[model samples]
Target chain A: MEQKKVILIIDDDPDIRSALRVMLESAGFVVGEAANGEEGLKAVQRIQPDAVIIDLMMENVDSGSQVAIKLKEDKYPGPMYMLSSAGDAVRYNIDARELGLAGIFQKPVDPKVFISTLKAKLGVA
Target chain B: MADSSGKYSQSVLSKIIRFFLRDEEGSFPVFLHSLRLEDQLYDFTIVRFSVAFLIIAGSLFAKYILEISQLNHYALIILAIILFFANTINFLIAYPARKKKEKSSAYRFLLIFILHLSIATDFIFLTIALWLVGGVYSPFQTFFIFHVIIASVLFSPLISFAYTIYGYLLFLTLAIVSWKQWLPPIFPIGAVPSDAPPTGKYIITVAVVQGLLFFLTASLTTHLMYFLREGQRQIVRINKDLERLCDQRKGFLQIALHNLRAPISAIAMHLQNLLYGYGGELNDNQKSWVQRSLTRIDELISFLHDLENLSVMENADLLREANEFGLNDLIEKIIEENQDLILSKNHEIKIELPEGKIFILGIQRLIREAILNFLTNAIKYTPPNGKIIVRAYRYSSCVRVEVEDNGIGISKEDIPKLFREFVRLKNQKREGVDTTGSGLGLFIVRQVIESHGGKVFVKSEPGKGSIFGFELPIHIKK
Candidate 1:
């Protein structure tokens, strides 16, 4: 029996998280959820998911990139992606590759493309 | 510009000039570069005070420290005391006015009057001191150049020239008259080498040469003042224009960002639900809802397209894919894309093109958008079932495209304002017309056409119709 690939989702908007959860679940991946960057950090520690998808979630404790940097410093061995709502992720001026992000997925991500990108980066089916 | 310490001084100075100098409104900061009248007065006041104090210290230093005979320490000391007392009394009155926030108009009038009197008195005392020291041969006569320079910085060129002449006349009268055998002068001032009586020709020649030098000083300083004032005014004007442009850019971005973010997010949630089969396979009702959402998304995409087109033209960016392309082909493609809207509105759009392929050299991206803007504008402004005639033809070296509609036309007064950013005509609304224009379309068209060294044309009668379009040169200058 094969084990399910676990993906963590971090977003302040409940609707966005639930919508993403349904898509990922349908794609045969277990989805973990957190409301903000702090909970996301704790979730990363607890769940140890294979891949992490975080929202921009501005006007909260720390921005999306700050959480990514902290998780990397904490030695969270997982591929990370940012789901940005502000048109695109490049506007933040954050270097995705340097920040150890596999890629940036613009908000309202197409499920097929999102899953495929994750599969390619994680080297999974 | 009005600092806290100098606020009172400025208000008073401006008030005085407003009341007294009728021509001040026409030309301001007339002498000093950017200094207000009050700031210039303060500078003049400080310089006058320092000079008076320096004269007293300088005479005392020379009389006691160096101790040269025939120095006439008695006369110089008396002149220095008079200058010092006169300046001190004026300073006492002006100093309180400079500090006080609310001064009466009468007091302000007095302070302004005192400043003029102070400058006038400086000339008399300095001239006397110069005569006592050595008359025409006085080394301290060099200070007269500074006097002329200050006058030029404060007054107009003609007045400064007159003041320079006054200085020379004083020198000739005092030094030349007292030395005459026939003149009953109380005391006589002399040349540097007074052992032998100097020739009258030598004295007259020195006075003439000194007068020319004073005139030169006045002319040069006034010239410098004119250039400085002009340059400062230019910088201030440029700064105001830059601020206005920045404000316009800020407003544009706010509108663009708000329009992009909200609807896209709303559409995205529904799209993910329908496309990914969030719960299960959708029924017919759910399918119709999804279809409507998709249509909304299409509208959003077109709006985003317009935004991107306007922004690129705003930046005047040259597209990297720019190459020779057919103008007729671009227009035909745009019409085809908008065919559905035209048919639905029942607008009969007739396009007239040149016989063969008319090619133009430039970025196709902006030109395509510009023509699309024209076609769409004509379609929207005209009533349902109206005639929209689009013509593209050769005019010597240029290609002209016109979108003529016998629908609602612009008024004569409003025609000039048609191509400006965010301009909606007063009478643009009509039955069965899409009056919801972003108002940026024609502005973008004008920018694109003019940037190619081409021109836009509009001819209209309010009740009859309007012809709106642009001409682009085949060989565009890079």
Candidate 2:
């Protein structure tokens, strides 16, 4: 039996977390969900997922971005994905390519495209 | 009273005419000169024709009514011929000289003196003739009042007073001489004997009444004219003060906005670097958090920008510089620039613009900022795979641009305050979107549009789509 690839999803919206979880699970990967950046960080430490999907705006205001910075500074080896609203993407200078992010998706993400992009970034295709 | 050197000087007369026609250099002076000349020609023709008709009719009536022995018929005929010759010579000599030296002050004074002298001669002759016919009971004494009134209204008060004195003296001299039986026994009416002495008391009473009436009318008219001129001066002063205050307010606002720009720009740049991993390589979780912080910084900067614009709008004269541009091109550029965000959500943008160029006058940068704000808000509220349609068309006297989105529309309560600064819907708050925005986007948009003399309107229903539209005037320059 092969070990299933685990991915952590950090977002304040329940709909987004649930949708991401269903998409990753259906793509033959194990998924973990946290309602905030803090919870997401904890889940990352405990589950050590192969990749993480985070929202740019969430509780604690920029906690998700702070978590991403912390993980990178700590030399944590995992792919990161950022999800932002259209306004946020324009207002904030978030370049996924430059930030070592595998991809950045605007909400509400499509289940099929979300899964495909995640799989490709995680080398699970 | 008769100083030979004090007689009306030609130089003084020339100065007066020159004052009336000081400048012939500009278009206004030329127009005025032509108008004056036309008026003078019209007056001359009318006066000459009317006076000539009056003289001819008067002589014909005298010839038919009087008997050969009544009053001295031969002397009356001689006096009439002499008066007619004198008038003809004055008219012929004066008219040509007036035309040649119309703009000369000395000519104007001479013309006025000659007119007054002619009137004085007519009055003296008429008075002598009336005295010969009916002493103080002559009906022609009423005509003396006309001369008094004309002198008071047209001449300065000093000149009018002098004319009044001269008239009183003349009346007194005629009355005394006729009463003493020193003048000829001339009478036209059979009712009055030629030996009857003129009534001194009646003549003096008439002169006093005429002088009083002339002074009263002249003084009252001058007072009214002065009052109106002063009122106009006060109104002009008030308008100048208001303009000065408005200019000062604009100057202060410009200085304040210029000072705020540097600080806001610095903050935004620093935040941008942090979000982009200029500090260090961000792990999966760190990158997401930093990006969130950058959004909040951007929001704050946008709010500052709005405040600066609102200040600019206070001074109407310092409004944004407008230039003509193609509306379609501007919209296309904004859409293309934000393509990544639209693509990320799988949202489709549909642009429905007129086929030809929709030329509009606006500040390109401000218009772009306003449109970008609208598009961002549309995409922010819309759900995944939602559609945004931007339409542009020319309305009467204005151009209308609308952005419609089929997304989670604004609630009824939030719609009213959607354009207010720092006002975000409760739902956006519930989503834990803690972007550092000062929430001044819509407010800025409204201010910018209004500064251009345009208007912005929004329509939204919760759970339905939202439509935002703005109209700009077609001709904004003037």
Candidate 3:
């Protein structure tokens, strides 16, 4: 038996958070949730999640991306992905590698693609 | 006149000043007077200073070269210096009043009044100088016309008209006094005390002609100013209306897209859940329909994103903040970050960066967006296992970046159709490729590159692969 990978989902919208949680949980991953970037940071420290998905436009523009930068500065060793509502605008304004984001998922992300990427990266069956 | 700034803004004098403050008329009760028209007063001071220079030069020329004993060189030089000092002091004091970010209407009223007073006082000085020289018969008596014209241009027509009448009255008085020989030997320039004075009829005739000339200049200039101001106000009104309409359209677009995006995203998520068996098991037919709807929703999301990018690219603030960044470093970072995307397409990306760092001056985010557009576009249009060669190096004086891809190419004719906004291609939509182009992606790319003093270039044929690139002038650090 293998341990399930823990993923933290940070978003302002409860619906979006819940949707991500359902998709993650159903895929045999443990899902943790936070309402904002600050809480997400604390949650990452506490949960020590294997992966994190942050909504780029939570509370303010680029707050989620800024949080990712902070997490990377704090030397958190985990894969991070950003969910963007403004796909190209967010992509252009930020350097994904500078923020240490593994990838960006567009809003209403494809569940299969997201889950598969996480599963493949974590090397979990 | 002694009213507080509040009461003074509502005063009739202030109303008239406000009316003429802005060259272009706008809504009344608007905050802040234009600093532009106020700047014109500085122009007037320049002219006044030039006149002072001319006065000093002329008097010196008359004394030393022309050897005119009758002209009082001392008094003329003194007056010239006085004009210089007075203008300099007034400029230094009043210059700050117009430059404030927020202009009180009362402050503006004071500015106009001060300007009006200065021009009016100039006429009085001219009158005194004329009286000393020969009164109505003075050579510089005609100089009053210049002041009349200046007043007509800087102040309202009614004020100019009043000044014109005042000059005519002053002329009448001078003529009467000259006829009575009140100052027969005017400052050694006029007739000597022993010589006989001119007749009343002669004085009156000369004065009448001079007065008519004065009135003619004032009336014509004032009339011309009136028509020009009316035209300016009309154009300004039209421009304001157009601007308001454009802002409203942009606001509506932003709001409509934002409102549409949230609900559509929520719907897509729900649909995704159902398709993934969150609701229950679905038949094959249901699965196909759900996939189709999901694809459509994704396209809608992409279109909205493109639209937002369009608005963001046009933002003035984004264009204003320029930075110098290493071209190679940015390219390397972009490639590193987009490795997943490239790998997903099974495309082989070959990067050719200059050995040394290449610096370019531009809005960094906009430049990045443009470069990203070219890369993603190449990836999107190219078939799987296609080869993408991205090169950045010095080309002549400019640093050029090229994205060459071996994929389905566009004809020379279809090339131009690629960058236009919202124009979908008929021939380019291949069987396997997902072409969810808003047609704005390339348009945005062009805009961003062009704004950075760069030109985008593309080389391709219908069968062969495409090469898309741009050249930006190299930025050298001082």
What is candidate 3's lDDT per residue for B1-478, written digit by digit as tens? Answer: 2334345366777778656542333334322222255666665665678888988898788678866557776777888888888889768746775456787788777767767777777876677666666666667777888778877876678999898888777777776777787665464443222224558887868877888898899989999878877887898999999999988888888788777876787788878988998768899999999989988987887688788777776553644577889999889877876665676677999999988998988877677777877898788888888899999989998988999988778877788787777777677777545677677888887877777888888898765688889999999988
**Which CAPRI category fits model 3?**
acceptable
Ranking by lDDT: 3, 1, 2
What digit string (tens of lDDT, one per residue) describes model 2 on residues B309-384? 4553343232445578778888876675456656656789999998877777766656776887788778777777
Q: Tell me the deviation in Å of residue B57 in model 2.
A: 25
Better of 1 and 2 by lDDT: 1
Single out the weakest 10-residue window by summed lDDT for candidate 2 chain A: A86-95
lDDT of each: 0.70, 0.64, 0.78
Instruction: List model 3 lDDT by residue over A1-125, tens digit each.
Output: 88889999999888888778878888999999999999999999899999999888778777987899899999888889988775445334777777898887767777777787888888887
For every model shown, what is its TM-score relative to the native structure? 0.40, 0.40, 0.77
Model 2, span A1-125: residue lDDT tens:
76788988888767566555655665689988988877888888899989988988787555667878877876779888877643344334454544666666655454556666666767775
Report the backbone clash tally of model 1.
Answer: 0
Q: TM-score of predicted model 1?
A: 0.40
State the lDDT of candidate 1 residue by residue for B203-227, as single tens digits: 7787788778888999999999778
lDDT score of residue B165 within candidate 1 = 80
Q: Can you give the lDDT of residue B290 in candidate 1? A: 82
Find the 10 residues in a row with the least total lDDT in model 1 chain B.
B182-191
